[model samples]
Target: MTRTEELFLALRQQIVEGKIPHGHKISEPELANQFQVSRSTLRDALARLKSIGLLVSQPNVGYSVISLSTEHLMEIFYVREALEGMACRLAASNITQEQLQNLRDLLESHESSVQLKSGVAYIQEERDLDFHFVIVQASHNPMLIDLLCEKLYFLVRMYRYQFGMVSDRAKRAFFEHQHIVHALSVGDGELAEFLMRRHISASRDNVERNLLVNKGVIS
Candidate 1:
């Protein structure tokens, strides 16, 4: 990657990983110095992250990491349900046997982790992402891939990471993924879409309930 792209990737990773923390102010000059890049390059990188809604830029206020409210969580998943559900359907028709096998392998690994009570580990969560990502790519639509993999996927990860993933939730999510992949393996487009939509909707509900509980708005 070119220097600009490299810097962009670097900063983006930190933001999504919550290394810099949500709503943290970003100083362009300090970041430029830290990355040893010029101001223009840093701005380019920040702008790219900002474009994806990870950062907000305001006049006189500079940049701050975007916070995920319960409302925003629902909004993000609403789009996720539409886009990823469609991707799952297309994937059922378009995915190759090799890709299907890869997903199986991923689930197999997850199975081992779950059995060992390590399914909620950050590594497993990332591996879960790999399983979904493969399915999204299998959709064979460049626009869908770009929208999910490039943009919204990171935000989803950010929310998941920030909110938390308990072992039980992770284990349950793993089982759901198995069902979705099974639909894909069988080339059942409609089933895959239904299962995938349900999967994302479940995640949104889980997050919403958790947020409400945290706020003492729900038991």
Candidate 2:
């Protein structure tokens, strides 16, 4: 990767991982020095992140991490439901046996990781994306994947935080994934799509509930 690309990846990972909290100002000069890159290179990396809605740039004040809010969460989940629902439906028709086996393997690995009580930090996120990405690819829908990738950045950032708030939510999500996979394995498009939709809807509801509870808006 180019230096700028490398920097962009690092910064984006840090932001999503919560190493840099929302609304925190990002100092270009400091980052440039830290990464041992020139100001232009740092600016290029920051610009890429800005385009993705992860960072907002001010004329003179520099960039700050974008904050997650209820409105934003709703919008993200709405798009996810439509796009991911379609992906699941298409995957039901197009998924190969090998792909189905891969999905099963991911589920098995996820189950093992959770059984060890390994905190669901990296493994959960990795397996979750793996399962979904497999479905997305099976759909053979390039445009949908492109759009989903854009939205996924912010969704991952926001959901990861809220995910941590929900005890054992990752394991619950894994079980939901298993249901979808089982339906897919049987070539039941309707049931697979239904399960996938319900899974995403539940996640949206949980995220909204957590936000409200955290804000004292719900009992």
74 Cα displacement, candidate 2 (Å): 2.5
For candidate 1, the TM-score is 0.89
- CA RMSD per model (angstroms): 2.9, 3.4
Measured by lDDT, the strongest candidate is 1
Worst 10 residues of 2 by lDDT: 119-128
- Candidate 1, run of 10 with poorest lDDT: 120-129
Would you list the C-alpha lDDT of every candidate in the order shown? 0.81, 0.75
Angstrom error at residue 94, model 1? 0.5
In candidate 1, stretches whose alpha carbon ends up further than 4 angstroms from where it belongs are 114-129, 216-219
Residue-wise C-alpha lDDT for candidate 1, range 1-219, written one tens digit per residue: 878899988887898778988888998888989989998888888899987789998899999989767778788889989999999999999998888888898788767764436655423455234777888999999999989887787887787676665634676787789999989988999999999999888877877776766794312
TM-score against truth, every candidate: 0.89, 0.83
Tens digit of per-residue lDDT, candidate 2, span 176-218: 8988988888878888888888888888887787677778432
lDDT of candidate model 1 versus the reference:
0.81
Clashes per candidate, residues 3 or more apart or on different chains: 0, 0
